[model samples]
Target: MSESSDRLQRRSAPKRLTADDWADAALAALAERGLAAVAVEPLAARLGTTKGSFYWHFANRDALVAAALARWEEVSTERIIRAMETAEPDPAARLGALLRGATLSVVDDPLEVRLLAAGDHPEVAAALARVTERRIGYLAHLFELLGFPAPEARHRGFFAYTSYLGHAQVAHAVPGAVPTDPAYLAAVTAALLKR
Candidate 1:
């Protein structure tokens, strides 16, 4: 092979980028340039790799989007579900605790907030809706554990999900917002939950 051909082949050989690494690079690209900038070509370039690597790991753009949504769910919705599951289990206190834990967890995690805030893409929105529904169902189950009637528990669960997401939306839109204050959020959530 010619010298140029050899160099090109060596450079194009797959580099090791884990799912987490690709996600991280994609998140950074999302933050630095916004959602439109997160196309696979740019993401691949950002990872010091190529589009072939992305397809090798994911089925298509839809699949990659699902991965991003899954990661967001892991950090955001899953945290809430896990917190509710492990906390005191009194519906009110558990709800408060989940919000508190999630609020604390959000400190400086802008990418997490941004991804959660993205309800624009139809696929992302669908994935998030599924995650949110599961979370609400879990919350309803938690309420049933606390003596709430079946229907009431279901309504409350949906309400809680909406409230938390609403807060996330507000947090994402408010420039210079920080999750440094626990007492305020806890107090706010506690008051809000009791209503």
Candidate 2:
């Protein structure tokens, strides 16, 4: 090795990356580069670290993937669920507020927009489908409690749920899409709530 190379190698510090670091990098990679680009080397590079640090923090790639999903569930789904649950005594109002807040937040996530646009990430696809299903179920229950028949409640809930997904796509796709705007979102949502 050249003198400078030898000196640089000798001067390298020991790796000290933690699990949270790896998870953060992994999440960013998933949201930005799509899942395929999130291998150990790239994530380590994104972290300004190395693969050794990743292996130390994660058992393998799957573990990292699980961690990323868990983090999303914690911050996104769980938080929204809590907010809606606590919003009010009225289910419609509470769910509406939650959906409105969610739409607004999702509008700001360009990375999420791109990731969904790319159509990769089977894991996220499956997980989000489940999340959507649960949300639809919640809507159904709420409508039922509001005095609608079960079938009608489910029908309206499905309509609202699907509309939200479509609106989310538009919000992420159109250059100036802002379906998340509170007043606009309320108007759109109020229109959809009709059976």
Candidate 3:
């Protein structure tokens, strides 16, 4: 075989797909086509692989869905919270930053809206519940730091979270109406953080 043929053969060889790759593809499917779209065969086709590759990583479709939700929580919620904690030491500033980040763009965070829509599914419901509790708890802690009483802090936390959910839902519904301006985000952050 000539050198060019060898190079062409190497380029045509299949790339090995990992569990993360499957989970990521599943997430994209979930975001684009609801949770029902996340199937082994469809995802395998999307990845340009076979069902065998999926089975190599996950036991079944449910397992892949669970993995995708876990990955979403890790990257979207946990990672963002960690970054905020590190970047903003002041509780007020941290809360403002969190609100600003949450309201950044509805289109940019379609996965969140998709997950909310899939909340009827057992695994999706459980994952949503866990994420909701975690986010509320963190926001409550920040409120406490800002000197609010425990009950009040919890109330404020719920308010903030619900506001975010409402905004996300609206944005998803009418993508064009949702403002992406920094001033709009700042105004939202101020309103949410107001005692």
Kindly report which residue stretches of model 3 are placed more than 4 angstroms away from their true locations once superposed.
1-13
Compared with the true structure, what per-residue lDDT tens digits does model 3 show for residues 38-83? 9888898999999999889988899999999999889888998999
Output the number of the TM-score-best candidate. 3
lDDT of each: 0.69, 0.72, 0.88
Root-mean-square deviation of every model? 6.3, 7.0, 2.4
Regarding lDDT, does 1 or 2 come out ahead?
2
lDDT (Cα, tens digit) per residue for candidate 1, span 1-195: 999999999998766787767666666776555566668988887777888788777877667766766776675577657755675756667767776665555544555556555668786678767887888898788667767788888987787667666665566678446454777777666554453
What's the TM-score of each model vs. the native? 0.69, 0.75, 0.89
Where does the lowest 10-residue lDDT sum fall in candidate 1? 104-113
Better of 2 and 3 by lDDT: 3
Clash count for each candidate, listed in order shown = 0, 0, 0
Whose lDDT is greatest here? 3
Off by over 4 Å in 2: 1-21, 111-122
